[model samples]
Target: MVEKESSRHPEVALSLPFTGLWLARNSPARRVPSHGTDLFGERYAIDFVGVDERRRTAGHRDWRTFLATEPADRFFAYGRPILAPADGTVVEVHDGEIDHAGRRSQLALVPYMLGQAARVRQGVRAVAGNYLVIALPGGAFVALVHLRAGSVRVSPGEVVTAGQHVAACGNSGNSTQPHLHMQVMETRDFSVARGVPMAFRHFRERPRGARQFHTREYGVPAEGAVVEPLPLPGAHSTS
Candidate 1:
């Protein structure tokens, strides 16, 4: 498949939402643009799924089980901590949506894909599920969606620092598996927001075949790449 052009567009400084090896999907450079709407602020959104060293979503799931279908818990990302991607004030928070089961089966995915329009019409809660919107410096509003149920730790008006534990990844809303869906917008209200460009700061990127990751600063990870966040210098304790 022809890849969508990787965006070299510079954006506000941000950080990867999770630690460890997370595989990027539907990235801005994927065959298609990362998301469906530029109207309600998701033009450059990206999806991330956790993976292990073997490049599998799970350490020991049968290949047949992975491709055919399984519960959301079967994936490697379920309940994993999703850190604050940037320091910001929480402008919006939505919770209480059921963390639905996963659907890796193409048979299930085809129907789910077809029902996307219906889900859209159901409104923000239907599409984003439980989520948080943070208003950062420089007028960027970041949305971290598809969060695990009962895992959100901040309130609408709370101030969050970068690297803080915020939520867990989950297969919520329209998500077929537990993953983090992150995007930056021009405004706080998603209904009228416009997607803004964004690149994570101080992360490590490993291309599909690379044995080691190289430090990346202010870089947007390519589609289908795996990445991890590096702690800021002196941020980790030796103990």
Candidate 2:
């Protein structure tokens, strides 16, 4: 598959959502944790949870547990920068809630496991964890979920450019680990919002278990696929 090209503002592009180590790309075969129900009446699909390749060796025993506590001096661990996918205004920002502990520990897992449903039914504040929704100029809204509490840098009605940092990734809401859950939707209300399949422009996609990175103008990583943002010039450009 090919990536769609971004002709404008090719450089000065936003840094990737994470730094340091690489990560698994999008693919259906991968088995990451997922929230929300699926098309076949399944309650979930494998979503991007746990640590990406960059944070894999932080010495935490379990991925879910690491998100709950303060780890090494990495801000992105709980507060990675969540950049705007496209220029837009802050239609919504959800914050002010504490993150839950990782589920790897028996102590942490026991309580969370029991109260999972109760927390979910509480609504967006409870289920989305900390989140931000931006309205793109083109009539699409982007939802960035699992953001750290008190880390949202943008506010409602604020206008932001594409690739601008808005918030950091976090383990909150229904998340079992530290990872960013991004999706495009047509509506502002997540309760009624249906996910729109999205593809990235000029992003580098290296298939999981593959040795080389394939440059694309635009493409969608499969459910379990791993990807990294590539530098420009060598990175493909949009037409």
Candidate 3:
């Protein structure tokens, strides 16, 4: 069931949840009800798919790209470390779902899309797959979903700082490809939670097809923009 947003929801400040370049999809900067529904506290949710310098989702494509499902690991986002967006305590964690194969072919996606309702009916585990819910200081809860199977590192009640690694990206639950699905919510129980607005704190973004990048002090990246976190002060180089 979809929950309606209140007249006003304050925006929560967060850091980008992963390192390296990623393409933003279903961003609230593009539209409200970002994912096209208020179900599962996704009204302001955003998705990020890791991409290469040339912006390819995968290093290569083959018959599976057009006619069938591909291995989840074939996508650049698969297994990439998923970081904590803010200082918080792990309040919930689910790591039982299997990381499924990825789908890029419309033929493969067609049947998957038809199963969306069934997945929702199966509840949070079926739709969110392996996931983590972190409780922020002021009561908002941030959810990182579709995590790689067997990759969750923190247990419930564990405290975590911003930029700390929590899991890895994976193709699971309702996703078509390996990507991170993120959102903030009014409550810890997503089954009845309402969406909360959110913005990433410091990052660099290059719009799709653009030649240069721009720094964002604190805001949501536009849909299709490739984004990465600005290096933290004095951090050593690592790729």
Candidate 4:
């Protein structure tokens, strides 16, 4: 276990969870509202898909198809680093959920979609695959969900910082495909943790239909959009 506490380094900005190339932004392909419960009405502020060289998405419609059919291994995020988004301690860690096979066929997804409530009843054990909860120094808690099984590198009580390599993203939990689901909460108990809107600092932002990336100090990438993680100065988006 890396015991070196990292809260002191305010200068280093950690890499986004997946390293290579981002395929989507914070939300799904359709720009849908992103709360665990549609009835809850909480909105996701940042994007989940990281845009990099391998991206081929032109819009939400294209991404929806790609997510359903792509082979799990070809859509590999197997070794991708699950970085710490803030300086914090590992207050909780849950692992051992197996990654499910990707369901790209809308027909296949339809059955599961109809059974969504049943899946939820299966509870945290069924979904949320491997996960970790971190308590940030300022009292905020961040949840990293759908983590790759057996890839968690930290344990409870361990201290981590923004951008530290913690785990790898995987096709676990309620995910029909491999992707990372992240959110901030005021508390560590996720069942009751209300999702809080969060933002990336000094990152690049590209509005839909724009040809270029703009440097942003604090920005929220939309659901299903693809964005690349850049260094301090950020970079031109390939969208």
In model 2, what is the error at residue 155, expressed in angstroms?
0.8
How far in Å is the alpha carbon of 166 misplaced in model 1? 1.0
| CA-lDDT, candidates in order | 0.80, 0.57, 0.90, 0.61
The residue-by-residue lDDT of candidate 4 on 9-101, one tens digit each, is 122223354445454444522433455352211234233543344353212334536445444544545446778776789999998988776
**Candidate 3: pairs in clash:** none
* lDDT of residue 81 for candidate 3: 95
Q: Between the candidate structures 2 and 3, which one is better when assessed by TM-score?
A: 3
Per residue, candidate 1 scores C-alpha lDDT tens digits across 147-181 of: 99999988988888888888899988989888999
For model 3, the stretches where C-alpha displacement exceeds 4 angstroms are: 1-9, 233-239
| Candidate 3 local lDDT, residue 44 | 92
TM-score of 2: 0.71
Question: Where does candidate 4 stray beyond 4 Å?
Answer: 1-15, 23-33, 36-47, 50-54, 57-71, 233-239
- State which candidate, 3 or 4, has the greater TM-score: 3
Among these predicted structures, which one has the highest lDDT?
3
lDDT of 2 by residue, 84-125 (tens): 766679999889877754454455666677987797578777
Q: Once superposed on the true structure, which residue ranges of model 2 sit more than 4 Å away at CA?
A: 1-57, 62-76, 105-111, 231-239
Task: Give the lDDT of residue 67 in candidate 3.
Answer: 99
